[model samples]
Target: MSRLPPAIFLMGPTAAGKTDLAIELAQALPCELISVDSALVYRGMDIGTAKPPSALLEAFPHRLIDIRDPAQSYSAAEFVSDAREAMAEISASGRIPLLVGGTMLYYRALLDGLAEMPPADAQIRAALEAQAEAEGLAALHRQLAEVDPESAARIHPNDPQRLVRALEVYRVSGMSMSEHRARQRAQKAGAGESERSILPYTVAQLSIAPAQRQVLHHRIEQRFVQMVEQGFVEEVETLRERRDLNPEMPSMRAVGYRQVWSYLDGDYARDEMLQRGVAATRQLAKRQLTWLRGWDGIHWLETSARDNLPRALKYLESLSILS
Candidate 1:
């Protein structure tokens, strides 16, 4: 049998050294780097997003970074579309696509097909946002818990964007988002379709998970401190100055950016902000790992393992996607 063309998924929690591994793989393989990160898509979000430096990017270019303004919203659906096009382009040029990032949702949407849910209803979304403002996101999340406990449990109360979206999905379709997804899965399975092959490509997934969770937590804290030292606060301040941007915007809600925005708004002191930022990042990593755990056919590597690249190469070679 002919081996399917390969697409590499280098996924992990934040501060997992995915970027360096991706560059190393790109050098060793015929692959193009396509960022699977949502935050990296925003132009001015470099420092907080931990985007690769210009010199490094010049050496190993990553597609889909700096593609959006800070105020604009980029959804998982959009990421799937953009990634498919980039992957096709790369494959046509006889190069594999190495998608690298911590955005598990984007990775899932690209790999496992999403249900054909209704598109965003701006009027309904606006109304939901208004209601959230009046009643608070936690309150809205409570309402979601009543309707879609599965989604509510998965979504954080402080996550207004997801809260509003879940509520909007329910209000519009009279069915919870989780229910819709479940139904989609049932239908697909009944039809003898593989949910993981949503897109037309052979994928070799590589996940970098730290053996000790505390190791990841420590890395998260240290990375945030480094981000602060690298002008993360100034980056958020610049975005804060933009009239169109605000704390509620999805871009600003990014882990470090959100905490820094709160600090800038006098919501907390610098020390508290640093603490909250690190905590929020750790939470984000935990969430990413949860998603990673549920995924199938991934080659898991301990992030602290010294020979991760060799292990990943061996796994890919075993699959005949790399030789």
Candidate 2:
């Protein structure tokens, strides 16, 4: 085996201080930050997406953020291509690529190659949406659990976008998303191990998480409250007024954005929106943690620890990826 150039991954649930830690790492090492988040790709989605403030973003200059309009869609395949390109550009400039975010599916697609799946079928998706509306998302999730339990376990009941897509895949192809992944894995296992990494560089993954579950829950609630105070509702309202956007679109379906969009649509009152938004965010964090636990070779640090920075640096130092 031969050594490949190194790239760093900073993964964590939302409100885990990943952005702050990435900034510190970029300042301390020769690295360029590349955002791995799905929601941050859209412009004008700042407050609800928890995007870094303009000043902070200007200073840090993360790649792959604000590169798309909310009306457009970004798929995992696109993310793989974009992330690989950014990684190569940074590596060519003799800098480490520090990828950071809580979007686990993006990270997974980048690391383990995405399975060859069918494109989005509008008819199938529309039927699933109709089913969701008629019976609620819980009913659809229950149906998914029967057909594709593996994906159902990973996807939250409230994550209608993913749930709809999963059922769509099953309906269109007669194969679950989990089955597609299994086939891909079997193919890789049969193939020779010559090309282990799809990306050019070897990856060193670092994870930040709170040791206590209640502590993380508290932070999630606090952060959502702060976002509301900072005009999250107003932000969603502006997006809602756009004729091209809708609540069903992928961008509008992001955690807080979706709930706020519902509030704006008169589906719920402001107080209910706040409660639902925070609860949805907590569920999102729980799902992210589930994804993180399945990954191998990650150095986990407690986000609430005072010495998290030093501990993270120590891990990088041990890997000889940082000075």
lDDT of each: 0.89, 0.89
Model 2 per-residue lDDT tens digits across residues 1-323: 76677899999999988988898888888889999999999999998888998998888899999999999999888999999999988988989999999999898888777888778999889989999989999999999999999999998887788899899999989999999989878877778532246666778899998888899999999999999999999998899889999987889889999888878879989899989998999989988999989888999988867887788888888987764
The best candidate in terms of TM-score: 1
Compute each candidate's TM-score over C-alphas: 0.95, 0.94
Clashes of each: 0, 0
> How well does candidate 1 match the true structure in TM-score terms?
0.95
- RMSD, candidate 2, Å: 1.8
lDDT of 1 by residue, 206-297 (tens): 98878899999999999999999989999988888889988878888888888898898899999999999999999999888888888788
Tally clashing residue pairs in candidate 1. Answer: 0
On the 0 to 100 scale, the lDDT of residue 190 in model 1 is: 99
Indicate the worst ten consecutive residues by lDDT in candidate 1: 110-119
